[model samples]
Target: MVDQLRPNPAYIEAVLADAALSPYRTWMGLGITELECDRALVVLDIEDHHLQLRGTVAGGVMASLIDTATFWSAFVRAPADAGVANVDLRVNYLEAVPKGARRLIAEGRCLRPGRRLSYAEAYVRDERGHVVAHGMSSVLTLAGKGLAIDLPKYLEENE
Candidate 1:
């Protein structure tokens, strides 16, 4: 099991709902049904027209979802004053996305976190149990001013 540390779901849900991040998702609809400190599970339900001409999820979209899912596992657990950013992210695709796919799941976990950097990893797959992609991510913890100061009331403090 992952450690107790985790980001509040309400905060994460709000971020996922942010329209600015839409262009970066497989579904053009970023979403997270589950979230926590060391682990997170996000889903992307893209439409057929949203796909590229080749009928696959755009590479940039895939990369963005991968980066976001992995980073959440680190940042959600960060101190309220943390400043975490992804330093480097490497993703590997093992299968192509189906044209009529319903959604993609990005399951991520934080391997370790410290004063400077946090290591994270995730598996991207469809409902069919196929291991479509995977990745390793590196998140840099900036100085104390990491988190948004005026957090919304829905986002609870990490106990």
Candidate 2:
């Protein structure tokens, strides 16, 4: 069996910083706080735009959080020349978050990592630690098709 892979500190910092440059991630105010060999933690500070007509957190926001967190959890284990793409995502909204909620915490874990595919799950909690949503995803590991951008250049250009 191949040894499990872990992202080094530099790689972790790179990923966290690069993620902020993504238009969608930036618009959603997503921030990565911690990364491990098989897991990642992300945060979103709620803003007015994140609320729906009902004054609750938008479902789309939660879905995006789940997808992003799950993707990164598996991404850390992929080879340098490989990239993981989400094949399917399923999310369950457990509770509605009040508009006044200060933040949301998302935790994602890779359940299985394979050469061609991977599985991951994630959960979102409000500032009070109430479960707001949960999700699972199937991701395809594409060999010879790594991330399109050069991390160093991307960072420099964004900065």
Candidate 3:
């Protein structure tokens, strides 16, 4: 069995707290409360911006939640020097989130890990624990085409 490196807790914490690291996450007001080898838990506090003209949570918001959650779940299994990109994502919106819903939690789990591909599934739930959306995604891992930013060096410098 190949040994897998667990993501550092400090790094995850810093990533979540620093807006500069992920502008999209900051803009969406999303937080990652749990990140492990094969699972990730993300949360979003519903705001007016998240609602549509109908006063319910927009479909795009749920899509984004599933996308983010699945990415994190499969990312952990990727090689350190590899870049993972979602090649395919399928989402099913089950229930509408009312305007007054306070929060939404998205949980993602990696279903399969591979050298060049990974599969993940995610679910978005309302504060009442009703699943609002379900999603599945496949990520392609690219070797020698890692992220442009040097995350470790940046983290060290920031610390």
User: What's model 1's overall lDDT?
Assistant: 0.71
Candidate 3 residue pairs in backbone clash: none
Write one digit per residue (lDDT tens) for candidate 1, span 21-132: 5444534576766677778787787766557888888766677668877887776666655657888999998888887888888888989976678899988888797878
Candidate 3 lDDT, 87-114, residue by residue in tens: 9899999999976899999999989988
Which candidate tops TM-score? 2
In model 2, pairs of residues that clash are none
lDDT of 3 at 55: 93
Worst 10 residues of 3 by lDDT: 11-20
Consecutive 10-residue window with the lowest summed lDDT within model 2: 1-10
Candidate 1 off by > 4 Å: 1-27, 149-159
Query: How much lDDT does each candidate structure score?
Result: 0.71, 0.83, 0.82
Clashes, model 3: 0
Q: How does each model score on TM-score?
A: 0.76, 0.87, 0.84
Angstrom error of the Cα, residue 4, model 3: value is: 1.5
Q: How many residue pairs clash in each candidate?
A: 7, 0, 0
lDDT of 1 at 80: 55
- True-structure RMSD, every candidate: 4.3, 4.6, 3.6
